[model samples]
Target: MRREDDHPKEHCAIFGIFGNRRAAWYTFLGLYAQQHRGEESAGIASSNGKEIRHHKSMGLVSEVFDESSLDALKGHLAIGHCRYSTTGSSLAKNAQPIIVDYSRGTVAIGHNGNITNAEILRAQLEAHGAIFQTTTDSEIVIHLMAKPTYNNRIEGLKGALKRLEGAYSLVLMWEDELVGVRDPYGFRPLSIGKIRNAYVLASETCAFDLIGAKFVREVAPGEIVIINKNGLKSIKPFPEPKRKAYCIFEHVYFARPDSLVFGENVHNVRKRLGKQLAIEHPVEADIVIPIPDSGNSAAIGYSSESGIPQERGMIRNHYVGRTFIQPHQFIRDLAVKIKLNSVGDALKGKRIVVVDDSIVRGTTSKMRMRSIRESGAKEIHLRVSGPPHKHPCFYGIDFPSKDELIASKRSVEEIRKFLGVDSIGYLSLEGLLGAVSFDKKNYCTACYSGDYPVRFDENVSKFATER
Candidate 1:
């Protein structure tokens, strides 16, 4: 409901529909389901073969669109995006389903991940007399595709995608066709699904379920799929990378528990992570409690494994909006306090094992623990399902840099003391790998292990673009 936890945030979610008469309407529903990915912006672009129309704004999906607005974006093909700004400012202009016009036709793109080479590419494109419309990395793809290097639009798109060097799962709408492409590394999630005869695509399978669409499969790494009146056609344009660096943090955090990602159910993997956490760090607490929503599944698993009773020690207010204007220093802390309230009945006089997914900055964990202790809790033992986020993520997840991470410089004991918890334990990198239903080598654990799968140029840093 809020950024109360220290978990990493996913960039955004993308959804596209082709050959569906209810494209715009279904797009709204899909974006609503994926509002968790991004609350700062919501947008949809639609095309009826000849004309393209779009509506986007800096707000949640429900706040941005109404029945009249959805009806106005009438088309058989549409692509929608709900964004959590990772690389750009949280402004309305940066809202996605970025629509552009070129010689080929109208093109709109909704991108789900960050582009690591965006700074270099943007500079190169500008040197070639390119005029940029927005400050988003997503615009790099549009400019690259708009160039006249290839004979056909499809060839141009393929070449443009080949030049991309970071996480991107895209939903692009061209005249008469809707296209979906996942980066060669598969750093983000995108799936192909169907609602009867109409083909659908989204950043997660959860979007399909909301609109009663049947999930088919994931868009292959380095592959592109085009859906038009002629039906779905596949194009493999790039060779697979040596290692597919799918973000494992999708299971630990960043993903909605109801969604399926990286070929595994997010909820199931999180529960398994909790079970593994208990095995790795056993404690004798009277009751197991989660921070709520983010920690709910893991706490349940911990209780199941340790034979400790599970209770809802905290209640989350689901209606908390993304932003609030605070006029005072004490009011600033309302960001976390407004969303969570310690249930005194379950927490009072109990030695509690408080389970959470991860701790990004120690401030949130520290403040949350203090609130629990003030609620008459006797002892608070903090257990995390994911390993310490010690390094920055270069993919879609917007994790803070090395200096911002509490675990980067401090020892575990130091972190426990800083957070003011009786004790603190985090899942090991090995244990986290064991919990996810995939081979360890395939998933990227750079944030936890400080081992980046994507190499960087000598001149480039994660902050190059921002700088």
Candidate 2:
């Protein structure tokens, strides 16, 4: 059986550097820092102002490229991608920084979000005799750019972007220029950074931190930035929407705690969310323990607000890969057990409060609760940092369908009973928005409130482009 994480799968991470001799190395480091965003595969493409060369494989950044591989991709401008297969099957052919040589010139692209309208567009293009190599929606961009219909416009990139209907934060290497683009709705995060004279663009500011680069600013919702020998140039190709739909889940779970996304620090925002959760659902407990890694910041805030001591009740095995095979049917819950083991000494005979980012399908959460109960904990109060995820997400996040969500049909009390916890509390939608600095209307709470900013066909599967 295919083993999946309890949480929503993360989107891809994109990185690019211009005017740096060690561009490929820096890109590799950037990808390494943002590996949490994607872990299935990694690739890097570089341009030497003349020819474009690339190396990609179905593995981690450290596994895919070595010193010799980096040396072989010699260039002053480079772009990289680490992927999680949001739209296509996990295969070597789908690994990206997908390079192509067309009529305009050699161009490579690293994309971080999904295209909701790819199925419709692909059908139209195929009707006119267009050929495609990969099943990924990312490849549609290249075909659109190469088509005479879009290329004949003022600019091929802008024209192609105008036709797209969902989230996309792109890093493109077109000949000698490095390009970055964010969709008009701003459903994903992309930022600009600088190191010495070189310009950098990445999915998160944390990538800049790893390579000794300084955070510059975020690429605006509808903006496209081009970096070449002359300087950096900006263009607003699409009209601004009535409101921006920045994904709030980035703060709750996706981004690294040290990274800055959407003009706010992720760690601070998550702490605030935890504080809010404590305010809404205060529980009397002797100790607060996080789910680990993603839940650490929130647990700290919970402990601070409630005056409960914080402890590591459960330890995670970081070396465990994303997926593993189930050797036998009798070995149930082995995936969860392998990833986390309860600290019996810390949990035995203690009133424990467990904090986690969110509960998706509840399979892993149920198993975790059973493990805690087996450790002799007197009481187990489960706290979630965000509101219940009741709807499917179409803007890159790999959430299951609505029916698969535990909260979609069950009431809070029912869910608590199912998980076998003493009580369960999730942060309210209003409380979640209050934790962020931006206006409440600027955020997308579709997964909680079913208020999608962009409209899409309900019947279309998220993996419609997959063959």
Candidate 3:
């Protein structure tokens, strides 16, 4: 199967609660906290010692669950997921917190990242009488755990996790306990948190704060933490190599600015990236304007460093979902305009520096620049808060195909000409890593350098090659 390289890896968010009778509510709140990580669909599964109950549907967390629905779910151990598809096509059947019933028992798994060997593993399982339930790699883990070789459940979990490759931070729920496992490379983010007498597992620390769960510590790279009535027990040294390379994009755009991952404060890291970008490619402009939401944080950083006043030059229509099948060119063109509009009054006759999170297809940026120009901005200087995406990401990001990526083929000057901007600059790779204060060996800059942390098969390798 060909990889969908153009599709942004909708790095999912996973949240789980152990020991709380109100597990569903806390799981719902935790998933809501991580909604920025993904928004295509949501699901929650709860287990009350005897059986597992779940409610899953396509849509945002708010749209999927309400007061009545949460009331019906009963359990002390639960897991919730906010997902964006990466491995397979977007379909209702692929929505997660995938529940499975097998010879061992019932289990529900909510996963936060992609698996490179998912197809191979799925094929093996299918040959051995494992009936596939969903298109996600997450279900593979459930099948693996159900294998009869291991002496105990924890050993089964470790054995299963060891078989997988690529990015993953998974939370699996059984009848009595919630288990959290991070991949050996720690390619994705997972942490442990606590509220009064309860333990939590989540993709980001921000999810902990949402439910007033105190940040205890991160679930170490290859560690498995089991949360049950007894307390938190970590199966240490579960099998890690040397350094940890959490996906750097978690800080760049996918995460909510308030969230913290890999010990880096996301908002501050973005601001630092913008400040450094200004230093690398300073532009003379009257006001600094952000591309809204994602760019706002970095724009402030740019304004602070460049001594430019930060202004609201563009406004986004949050009503638009991530994907739309307009079918016709005219409708697709109109969708872009409807998704975002420049504040004509604020932009008029100003020397503007437009700061944005990152430019992928460049079509969106091109349209935004044209809108700002139409709004009468005298001079538009473009600044990106992250390095130009020179290669595609296989871990879990929805970067465009190599040919569609502006940076993949065009130089800075050519990109400026194409975007109709006076000057264009992207945050340097060093500056981006520095902004996040990441150890060089522990951050994946694969999209910028084509140096993936994990090995891949021939087909998967094609997804990362520069066109």
**Which predicted model would earn the best lDDT?**
2
Scanning candidate 1 in windows of ten residues, the lowest lDDT window is: 458-467
The models' CA-based lDDT, in order, is 0.87, 0.90, 0.82
* Better by TM-score, candidate 3 or 2: 2
The digit string of per-residue lDDT tens for model 2 on 362-456 reads 98999999999999999999999999999999999999899999999999999999999999999999999999998999998898999988888
Candidate number with the higher TM-score (1 or 2): 2
lDDT tens per residue, model 1, 408-461: 999999999999899999999999999877678988998999888876563576
Clashing pairs in 2: none
Instruction: Tell me the number of clashing residue pairs for each predicted model.
Output: 0, 0, 5
lDDT of 3 by residue, 225-324 (tens): 8888888888864545777777888788777777777887789888888899889989888999998788888899999999999988877788766555
| Ranking 2 against 3 by lDDT, winner | 2
